[model samples]
Target: MRRLLVLLLALLVATPAAAQVRTGIDVLQQNGFAQLRAVAARHGGKLKLAVLANPISVNREGRRTIDVLRTEGQAAVPGMAVVKLFSGEHGINALTDDMDIDDKVDAASGLAITSLYGRTDAEKRPSAAQLAGLDAVVIDLQDAGVRYWTFQTLTKYFLQACAANGVEVIILDRPNPLGGLAVQGPVSTPGREDYTNAHSEPMRPGMTMGELATMFNAEDRIGAKLTVVRTTGWKRADWYDQTGLLWINPSPNLRSITQATAYAGTALLEGTNVNIKGPGEAPFLRFGAPWIKGTELAAYLNARGIAGVRFLPVTYVPANDKLYPFAGQRVQGVEVLLLDRDRIDAPALGVEAVAALWKLYGATFQIEKVDRLLRNRAVLDQIKAGVDPKRIAAGWQADLNRFKARRARYLLY
Candidate 1:
C-alpha cells in the first residue's frame, strides 16, 4: 500500500497545469489550474497564509484565489489573511473591473489590503508585525508582460519584504498578457531601477511573473526562498488572447488584450506631456495631444509602414473625470490601429513614432524622458543625434537575443 501510494503521488506531481474551461474560468488546465488545486489538496492541513493579491488574481474557472481558499475550509491554508494591494495612482477600485468612470477607490474587492498604498489611511509597506507568522505568500496578480506595468514592480517589492521577513513566496503563474516571445528595447540601467524599471531586463521581458521571479531571484540574488507554481500548455509565441482565459484589466487603463499588446511601446510616453491614455476606453491603443497635428503625424507614421499597425489623425480629451490626465482638454494626435496584430512590433513602433514626432515638433515632442522607462540613456542620445528609429531598434537586437538566451533557462510554460 505504501509503494502504491508513492507511485500515485509521483503521477500527481508530474501532472501539468493543463487548463480547460470545464467551468466559467480557464483554471482547468493540466499544468496550470490543476497544479494550484493539487497544492491546496496537499496543504489541506497546512496553516498560516497570506495572499498578495489584486483584483485579477483568479483561476481559469473564474474563481478568485481568496474565494477558493475560503471555500476550502481548513484544508486550503487555514486562517489565510488577505493582504491589501498598493497601486500608486490607481485606486483600489481600479484594481478590478467596473463601469464607473470615477477612478477613485471604487472597483471594490471583498478581500481588502490593510496596508494598501493607494489609500491615505494605508501604510507604505506592511509592517513586519503584519507578516510575522505567515508561512507563505501566494502572488497571483495579472501582468501586462510589459516592463512599465506596476504589478511586477509590486511583486518585486513584496518579494524583498517577504525575504526580509523570512517568509516563502509561491507565484501562481499567469500568462504574460503579451505572450512570452518578444523582448524589446533595452535592459534597465542602475539608477533607473525603481518602480518603472525594477529589473535589468528589457522593456518587454517576454516572461510570466513566475518566470520573472526565477530570474529576479537569481540575478538579483535576493535570497528569498521562491517557488513558482508554473504554467503548462502555454507557448512562447502565444498572446493572452490565445490563452483560452478571460482577460481581466489589471488596471483601469489596460482594459483588453489588444491594449496590453500595444502597451509595451505606447506606455513609454507616460513620463512625457503626451497623453497615451486617450480619446476613449482603449488606452495606449491610441494617443494624442492638443498641440499635435494628427493628420500630418499620421501621414508621417503611416509612411514608415511599421509592420502590423496603421496610424490615423485623432483628437481626444482624457475623458475619465477622476483618473483622467488631460481632463477637459482636447488633444490632436494619431490613433494607432493594428492591421495585423501578429505583425505589430510595439517597441519599434513606439520608437519610430517618437522619432518622427521629435523631428516635426522638436522639443514639443517630449521624447527626452524615455530613458526612465527603457533605461538605456543611449536611446535618447541616438534620438538626439537624428538617428533613424529603425537603426535605434536594430541596436538592441543583439542585447535582446542575449537576454532571450539567458531567460530561456527560467521559462516554465
Candidate 2:
C-alpha cells in the first residue's frame, strides 16, 4: 500500500496542470455579461449591439462569441440584442482571400454582416448610418501581436468611428499570441500611416487588442467610452500556447503558433517579390521564388548566425497557381526553423533575410516594395546600400526605447 501510494504521488507530480488562462469572453460569460448589460441600461434599457469578430472569437468551450451573445447574452442580459456582425480584413468566415470584402449575411446567425474591409479607406469603418442605432460595439477579434496585421487597424478605426458617434466600445480581450513581452523592430514613421501601419508601434508591438484600444483611445484623443474586459490568469510573458487555448488560425496562412512566430519576420517578404506562402501546410514558415537557389540562400542565412533560428533548403511547386508566385513552376527557397522563440528577434531576422536576398538576387528582388510592411524607408535604404543588418537593427534602439516608455503607460498586463 505504501509503495502504491508513492507511485501515485510520483505520477501526479509528473503531470502538468490544465491551462488556467481565461479569455475576456469566458469572464464575461461567467459574470452573465453585466458589463454589457450596464451599457445597455444607460441607453434606455435597449441595446442594439454590433460585434466585430472572426472564427477565432470563441469562449473557452469553443462556442463562437456571436452565438453566445445572441443566445446566452440575450437571456442573461435583459434588453440586450446583437443587431449586426462586422467582418475585418478577412470576411466573417475568415476564409476569404480577397482584400476587398463585400457586405453579406451570415448564414449561420442570420445577421447582416458588414464588411469593414474594402478597397477604399472610407469603407473600413462603420458609417454614421450604421452607428446610428447601435448602443455598443463589442470587439472580440484575435490579433497576431504584430503591427502590420490589419485587425488592429480595424479595431482602431472602429474605436474612432464609435467615439465620433455616441456608441460605446467594449473590447473582449484575448492573448497576444506572441505574448506581451518583447517589443521589437522600428516604430512606424510619422506620415507613413496606412491601413497596415495604423499606429506608430514596432513591427511586433507585443500588445493585446484591449491594450491597443486603450492606447489608441488616449493617445489619439478619440475619447470613446471604452471598456476592456481583460483576460484572467494570463501573464505578460505567457505565449498563446502557454494559455492552453485552442489554436485557431487567426488568419488562414498563420496556421500554428510556430508559423505565427515566423510570420513576424517572413511576412515582411510578402511585400517584396518573394513568395512567403509556402510549399507546405505552413505559410510564412518558408519563402521561395523560382530564381532562388535554395542551398545557397540557406547557407547565406545560416552563416549570419542569427540567434534562435536556422535555415533549411527547400524546393516546391506552389499548389495554387493564382495565389502564389511561380505556382506551377518549381521554386527554391529557405525554410525558417525557429530554435528558440524567446531569444529570436524576428524583425532583425527579417532585415537579415531581405539583405541576403538583395545581395544574391538584387536584379530581380523587388526590395523597394518591402517598405509596405516594414514601415521603415531608412532600413530599406540601408539594406539596399549593403549596410550590416545587425548594425541597422541596433540603430533603432533609441526609437524603440522611447516607444517602450510610451507603451508602458498603456499596458494592462
Query: 182-280 in candidate 1: lDDT tens per residue?
Result: 677766665667666768778888888888888878888888878776666677777777667777667877888888777888877766777777435
| lDDT minimum window of 10 residues, candidate 1 | 97-106
Stretches > 4 Å off in candidate 1? 1-46, 76-92, 95-112, 115-124, 320-325
lDDT of 2 by residue, 198-313 (tens): 88889999899999999889988999999999999888888888898999877668888999898888788885667788434468888889899999999999999999999999
In candidate 2, list every pair of residues with a backbone clash.
none
Best by TM-score: 2
Q: How high is each candidate's TM-score? A: 0.82, 0.95
Q: Weakest 10 consecutive residues, lDDT, candidate 2?
A: 273-282
The root-mean-square deviation over C-alpha atoms between each candidate and the true structure, in angstroms, is: 9.5, 2.3
